[model samples]
Target: MKFVKDGASDIGMKLHPFTLRFVDDQAYLEEEYRSYYFSESISSIRITLVLAIFFYAVFAGLDVAVAKQYQTQLWLIRFAFVIPVLVLLLILSYRPWFRKNVQALVGIGMYLTGFGIILMIFYISKIGLYTYYAGLMLIFLIGYTFIRLRIVSATIAGWSIVLTYEIVALCFAHTPTIALINNNFFFVSANVIGMLICYFLDRTNRRDFFMRKLLEVERNKVKAANDVLEQKVQERTQQLLETNVELKKEIELRKQYEQERTKLEAQLMQLQKMETIGTLAGGIAHDFNNILTPILGYTEMALEEVEEDNTLRFDIEQINHAAVRAKDLVQ
Candidate 1:
């Protein structure tokens, strides 16, 4: 109902000390993100399939046009492009994770393989051309780059570029279909170059991903370890405080015991002194009583012998009084 701010607060503003928000775990957030990505990926795949179908129809129409106008044998090449692209789209749309990771690689690899096969067919048909196919390969290369599939994506792009260049050179060379084997140099060179570039890029990306994941794991581990260490320290500190409190109490008790011991010692010494005094007082009183009895008897006999007018009588009374004083001192 009420709040107090530790620092300066505006007139209408209130700060509640206990108000706090607990964030979700990192793993949970990651899982949620992955799920979102998977869902979006499914939609993208469906869109890709629709686009592929439209493009396949267009390629079919183009094949018919070329065949009607030029009597070219692009049918096999055109149909080849259509069938593979269709298969790839359907596979991606229906089974995103089908073949696990390798299948996806193969699916992407199929694009280049299909392009190469179409080129081979064109060369075989004596209607080999670069102007028509090169643009399509470039477009596919750029699209594959955007997919961000690391090695597979880079492989697709690199191969697309190299193969398109080779196809162009092959057209310029005007090599016979029978002599295609003699152009193996270009084929081998393109494959090797593309593979090397993709390999390098893939390695770099892999290292980046690995380092990021490692840092995240280490950060979480350190935080967990620190929390455990803090709890242990708190427990140990509390235990030490309790132990110190007990020690202080023990010290106080010991001090009290020592004080009581000292008091008892002093009391014992006092009692010993009193006991010695009592013994000395009793012995002196017995001797003084004996002395007084004789002195008193002598003094009384002298008083009777002297008569009422004798001068010695006063002296005898004085002696008797002096003896009485000595007896009182003894008592």
Candidate 2:
């Protein structure tokens, strides 16, 4: 349905004046209203049709009292024409096409119903049944309230009933002027009142339909916003999880690097101790070689001077051997 652009403060809706129907541009909304209105009012319409049929049949008793000579003929008109049509309309109310063109079809049913009464009045008024015109008011009431006819159908059916009554009463019946004027007053009053009720009731129904649709649109919008928010929350949660995993990997790498640095420091300290021990050992060996060199030279000079057969010569030979042994140890 199109919204009216008249700078209204609320949701905009516009309806035609005569019929109180949605504008032509709102065909889809009008169709939706037809379905909704039918569902809402169909049961009541059926009950009203049954009541109408019952009253029409019971009025056969009135035929007996009012016009005894033509009671049988009147019964024929009631049973044969009007009651059956009401029954047919009741049956068709469950059919599919009734929903599509509900107002037009209702107008037809109401026409047949009121026209049948006009025929009865046409005949009976000749015998001074001047009060019979009051029955047509019942048609307006039933069509408006019970049958739940929309303003368009009710107006057309009501005005047409009035027109038909006028033609018959004026042209053929030759009724008195006073009776015609009296009937016209009541007829016009009922139609006007019925039309007003029908028009307001329709306006209320259309307002309800628009509100329900607007509520649905609002609900869908909220759901869409919630979905987007949920998606963003999920994405941020995923990013945090990824960052946590990366930090754990970096921490593990730092631990491994600290262990490697400790191992390298221990190896360097051990290498420094080994080099200090080697330098101390080289210095001690050089000092012992210097002392041994002097002892070896003195022992050799004593061995050369000594004899082979004397005790002193034997002592000198032993000292030379000890000195030679000490020199080999130093080397």
**TM-scores for every candidate against the unseen true structure:** 0.42, 0.71
Question: Could you give candidate 1's per-residue lDDT for residues 1-331 as a string of tens digits?
Answer: 0111244231221212121111222222333333433443445444555565565546556545544443244555545555566566566545546424532553464455345434544543454432344334433433343233334444554566456545744675465555455344444554555555545543444344335555666677788899999999999999999999999999999999999999999999999898889888888789879978999999988998899898889999999999989888887
Deviating ranges (above 4 Å) for candidate 1:
1-203
Instruction: Report the Cα RMSD per candidate.
Output: 17.8, 6.6
Best by lDDT: 2
**Which digits, one per residue and each the tens of the lDDT, describe model 2 over residues 32-108?**
77788889988888888899989999988998989887787778789999999989988998898877776787788
Residue 206, candidate 2: C-alpha displacement in angstroms: 1.1
Query: Which 10-residue span in candidate 1 carries the lowest summed lDDT?
Result: 13-22
Candidate that scores best on TM-score: 2
- lDDT of every model, 2 decimals: 0.54, 0.81
TM-score of 2: 0.71
User: How well does model 2 score by local distance difference test?
Assistant: 0.81
